[model samples]
Target: MKALIIAATAAASLVSTAALAQQAAPQNPGPVIPGVCTYYNARLLAQSSAGQAVETRMQQLAQEVQGELQPYATAIQTEATALQSGGASIPADQLNQRRQALQQRAQEAQQLEATRENELRYTLGTQRQKITEAVSPILTALYQEKGCGLLLDRESVFMMNPAMDLTDVAIQRLNAALPTLTFNRMPVPAQ
Candidate 1:
């Protein structure tokens, strides 16, 4: 009847309005912001300076470790020479004992070297963490000040216009904000 047709039309109109309302809802545009993308490699800066300091420290530590092991090295060499020569007249048990002692000493040296390596690695990791922590705030400040949207690693970039290279500015700002080289000589723990 007429009522049934009117009801059908009203339902259709409500459905159409619901569809339109759904379509009209706002949607995210995906990271929309007005800013330039700049490449920044924080590790490169930390490594460049800290690497030199680590190398110097390692060299000194190596010399000290070597000096400590010099006597053991000489003793091992002497025992091996004795085994090779007529000193073989020495008892087999004694010879085996000497050889085992030499092996143990070598093993000790290896362990010491490993320990030093671990220490160096720990130092490097800690230093890098410290530098990153210190630089993060600086980078944030710069990013906010400049209204930068994204900061990418320089290494990841294939090619970019010179205008996109804010690395130099970042580096300069970081270096200027950092304490002097002498101050960086000490190891900094993670914050």
Candidate 2:
């Protein structure tokens, strides 16, 4: 994760600094981009989207799985309890059958859980992709239109001038252009 952050910072810094450097920029740059650097809070930016639908959908998926998966728990518990309470008194053949049945049910429950997890990962990936697709262009257009020398996520910066923040501006622009995102529920191809 730290590597990822460093890479992103390096990339954003290169683009903005290179632009200014080409035009006779400073050797030792200031923390703030004096005239053209803009910063934004990532968390706030995420919420600015129409309906915050990606997050909402993710929550819905979790809830749906939770509700459905409860039955698996109940079934496993019942089988285990019956075995623990009476296996010693039962005929050996009957006991063996029950144990086998219990193992089969456990395998099915595990498969259901694995499916739920795959659904979760798929939902998160697609929802984020949808949001990024809609937001990136808008940010780029604003950055170019504003002629910013640099754009940095506010989370990376220690301090900056309040006026230099572009989050609000970006949010307004994004909302106007993409009022809502209607995500596609594409089935993930079997891996």
TM-score of each model, in listed order: 0.62, 0.73
Tens-place lDDT per residue, model 2, 1-191, is 22323533554565465345436634544464554656453543355665366556555666677788889889889989999999899999999999998899899988877777676767567756655677788778877876777787765655555556676777787678777756533456687
lDDT of 1 by residue, 1-191 (tens): 22323533554564465446537645632343357666545333433344334335544544555676677678777867877794558798987887788788788877765555555445545655655665678678777877887876655654445455565566566566654232122333455
Model 2, runs deviating above 4 Å? 1-32, 39-41, 183-186
lDDT values for all models: 0.56, 0.66
Number of clashes found in candidate 2: 0
In candidate 2, residue 175 scores what lDDT?
Answer: 76
Best by TM-score: 2
Q: In order, what is each prediction's RMSD in angstroms?
A: 23.0, 9.1
